[model samples]
Target: MSEHLFSALRRWPDIEAPNLFAVDASDRLILDEAESQLADIQPGELVIMGDNYGALTLGAAALHGCTGIRVFQDSLVGELALASNAGDLADRYRTHTLDRALLADARLVLLQLPRSLAELDEWAQAIARFAAPDVTVIAGGRIKHMTLAMNEVLVRSFDVVNVGRARQKSRTLTAMGARRSLERPRYPATSVLREPEIPVVELAVSAHGGAFAGATLDIGTRFLLTFLPEMKSDAASAIDLGSGTGVLAASLALARPDLHVVAIDQSTAAVASTRETANANGVGARIDAFREDALTERPTASADLIVCNPPFHSGATVHAAVALRMLADARRVLKPGGELWVVFNTYLGYRDYLNRTVGPTRQAGRNSKFTVAVSVRA
Candidate 1:
């Protein structure tokens, strides 16, 4: 892959690399393409959201020319980069959403299509506000993630939006326009319904104008919830790590009133869903929802139990590093003797990582495609 990127760089030497900004940077084709595209630029400043392998490399290369680079992701990226001597290269690495710093100066912005359309709209609104008239925003995605509606949104936000021919099942959108100030659209929040059949809560989710399957429960999460343990723990504090829509967290809160569960997810939509689910289930007081990157923020050793169904893929890349980082963070925040219960696809090979990082791990249960693993902090 690196060789391919190097070749692309060598081949596309004529494309002037404007100050590059990559959103949702991951360790796959986008990064590879960006690196090849960015190699020719006289390094000045590079901004990226999150630490994917590709983004890290590009940021490192940019640093060689004394380029100012800023990375906004989860805290873990900041910590790892800092530890690896890339610390000084970072102008400001943060844990929240990409701020105006990137929007204010970036001549070219590269964004991977987000999973949700609501998120896409939010980002587009931001771009409309900060991007200059000459600035170009390039958005790319796999065939499934790209759509006419997305193109329409880009057109609405920018003066001119053009969709390029699909290459290798991926497409790029180029939007050029005068910076227009637009208010971010807000979606009405919905409520959830407590299910009597199962110890679960059903969140009433609105589509929020995104590509994600709306209102319906995710199949993977539904599968995980079915296997949730019925054992009552003596521990009072718990966390639903990646608690999308608060399905698992709401269940835990309803089933065990003594345990206080904090639900956290990276997506703003997911956070909103979780909150609504908690409220509808009447567990809002017990379940706290927050927007958080799994790789950032350490919540101390307060959680006696942590539950997660970690995402195996970010963008097009299927990598376990993010999941590994989540495990490490879970370990960091778990009290001594605390339990980390995780449900994942059987092939993810997270068992070995869990065993190595968070003491010995054991398969508590299993199904055809997924396995439940538990690790105890020593």
Candidate 2:
């Protein structure tokens, strides 16, 4: 039944391609490693983080008849996909933010180790600070993505970090014996931007653990900002699509005090990070940050300007579908003749897609690594 259930899982509402998958070997390995511990756990005591889809949560329920599960997924798409795939078992689990309420007294945790070490540290600290003193964390990832540093991060919070045998190029780390003297986790890390490339004198960026380019400006975004002066001057509204740390959104609000900016991303941390960044930059009133799968919830032909340093990867898979979707959606949401400015890796060659999806695209700027383009909505 577990095999059948895993096989039937789908990555809907997310980019579904032949190479991308809903569940991976790591998900299976984590469940396999936690089988004995799962049997010893009670309903509601089992917590699952970074489940990707419904694999860990539904797997626990289907395999062990566990109920009252508490689950936290960083991505809004992941949450929605889980709901879509959950079917009759949807009532068995509840979604939450990464807080004491989600980790409090959790006896057994199933985690899909995030690629970001900062994010791993945040999760480890939270588990240590709020979960049961004897809670065991069954965390797994692909061997290629996992590092000894991840175990070290867990060790900061857990006294004992046990390495599980590798299976199918995936491994699990069993972390137990939460440290008693844990300090308050410093998440949503804050930093000031003073780089010469950034037009803003001191743009403040606040980022949660999972936000991309946490609390700092990425080079791609920096390149994109160079063309900010050329953006639609008469525009009253703008969107920072896939806004990471709200750098673009905050910058837009600061540059044009009259403009209302909307920052959108799928990650819960990114949305909160964007809001924090806006407030830090004194543009909170002008910037509205929210979580959505791209601009799916946004009304059609509503915005006058949109700026995006679109992500080229979708959950570790280097694919163009995610960026293409964002571009297409930006077109759908832009009023006639509105501008869509984007920065991407030069190697990705997204201009053709921009021309096909958005409108007539033009090269706005380019460096060796990145290219900036502007597309007028047709």
TM-score per candidate: 0.62, 0.98
C-alpha local distance difference test of each model: 0.60, 0.89
lDDT of 2 by residue, 122-182 (tens): 8888889999998999999899998999989998889999999999999999999999674
In terms of TM-score, the best-performing candidate is 2
Residue 29, model 2: Cα distance from true site in angstroms: 1.3
lDDT of 2 at 123: 84
Where model 2 places Cα greater than 4 Å from the true spot, the runs are: none
Clash count (model 2, backbone only): 0
Off by over 4 Å in 1: 1-110, 115-118, 129-136, 140-153, 156-159, 164-171, 177-215, 264-285, 288-301, 329-337, 349-365, 375-378
Which pairs clash (backbone N, Cα, C closer than 3 Å) in model 1?
75-296, 117-210
Task: Supply the global lDDT for candidate 1.
Answer: 0.60
For candidate 1, the per-residue lDDT at 34 reads 53
